[model samples]
Target: MVGTAARALIVSERRITGLSQVVIADLVAELGPVWQARRDAELCDRPRRRAVGAGAKYKLVFVDRLLATLVHLRHGITHDVLACWFGVDRSTITRAIGEIRPLLAGRGCRIAPGLRLRTLADVIAHLGATGQTGIIDATEIRVRRPAAHRRGRNRFVSGKSRTNAMKALVVTDDRGRLLFCGEVRAGSVADITQARDAGLVDLLADTVHLEILADAGYQGLAAQTYGQVVTPPRKRRGKNLEQVQWLMAHHEQARFEHSSRRIPVEHGIAHLKNWRALARHHGHRHHLPDTIRAVAGLLSDQQATHKRKLAALPTGQSR
Candidate 1:
């Protein structure tokens, strides 16, 4: 976690020191077509570029601006607050977020089984680290008007909260390589429901063999799907000690150890929020979950890179 001092440093640097303007301008440049479309669509500015649009009608904005703006909204900052953060007009943000949505969605990179295999080689590294396959769990993403919030009506949930929200399913190997990211759906949906609906079973059947460790929420989903998993057993009435212990080993020993290591994955979730800068936990915020998942995947990538570098290091210093 970034300390209060670090956060203050950041806020002061951007807001008080007048870095907001330079950064926002840089972001508008970095995000390319995504920001450009937003700029033109919003009539943000008419900066001249030499045939930069190709056939497109907009000039580009930086990814950093778009990301920073997302962070502002996540923190529950108002449009005016965001304008203050960026040293721009409040309407610019509404328009930028409006245009940025489709840009991120439309750029969706489909992960074929083969790509999963290639990108997630580190799951095996995790298994080697611990004696378990991997862990699985589902989390809900709270939304405000999720129905009208995201582009797809299918992804929103109106029943889960006082407002709306979405549920996300994630699986990571023991070491934290995200194996799968199911479609974002409304929070009203059950974790298991989204797993099936999201096609996790199909993906596992075709491309994976490691056991999945999950919480009680995924009860029976393992057997129903792949006949594998190590989840904590539920304590029900009429069960004796032997029965309880017997129930425990459904990947019991491994899952316990798995949880010891796996619980840190929640930190990844926390890390995402740090980056997102959200205000309330639940909002009509649609794309934040996907961005968080993407960042998690990038974590695995980074770990893989770091590991390779370490492997190549001199033997004694390797860690």
Candidate 2:
């Protein structure tokens, strides 16, 4: 019965993932210039003597191929599968992706340049009436155990995957724009500990009352920074008046507003999941960090373009 139930859940995951991919593809399309710019490095880095196509005849639209790769990635498909679908070798797919990532950043996607994603207020304003506070937290990815891996460490597991792996601390703003991501760490790392180590708390503290909202994983961060936290109520032996108010939903209106504020982060994650590079990272020792930097950088570029387009749309059409 347990095995049967797990299969059902897996099927459901596959069923709904199509919606996620469509959303991801549309999002990637907005950053056409970003991908086109990387064509040279991506094609040149290939181990082959001949290009996929010469000049414009056999050329693939960087954006379309990128979208194709994203759809294939949604299922944790292998590079072999990706190569077959895209008519390239597994290594070619990998190299093309890697070479194109950094350019996606630094060029059109410089989020605050010297600083991490711009101020929380700036993010909120861009999200507009649909958003309120900045939500910050880390998300994890799963990987197969290393061959040399052994022992009771098997007790450490993730709900995301059946294999062994670690986590990356993702600090995102209210709209789900990834502001920062920490170095990969063991999944066992505590949220608070990772948050601090990743410098999210420091960023929040730099501003006064900017309202850093997160799940309960962020203990005392809200009060310490004079920001508001929106985690669900925690079950503890005791509670003080100050803490109680923070726990209360206040009213139906407050509840709706709270839900809206956190929507971006969740939606953003859904969007990121479309890129296989971010979702099922095999942690290709060499490609891991650079992949994260490129993909995250590309996602950020797409995000800014999304905001810009919405701002240009008639107010009635934007929502």
Backbone clash tally for model 2?
0
In candidate 1, what are the lDDT values of residues 116-150, reduced to their tens digit?
A: 32222333334434556667676555545633445
Model 1 Cα shift for residue 58 (angstroms): 8.4
Residue-wise C-alpha lDDT for candidate 2, range 7-91, written one tens digit per residue = 3343345342333333345445555666655555677777866665565452334543554444444455666765675565677
lDDT of 1 at 264: 49
Q: In every candidate, how many clashes are there?
A: 23, 0
CA shift at 158, candidate 2, in angstroms?
4.2
* C-alpha lDDT of all candidate models, in order: 0.51, 0.54
Q: How close to the true structure is residue 81 of candidate 1, measured as C-alpha lDDT?
A: 66
Once fitted onto the true fold, the runs of candidate 1 whose alpha carbons sit more than 4 angstroms away are 1-64, 70-76, 101-132, 145-164, 177-182, 234-255, 276-319
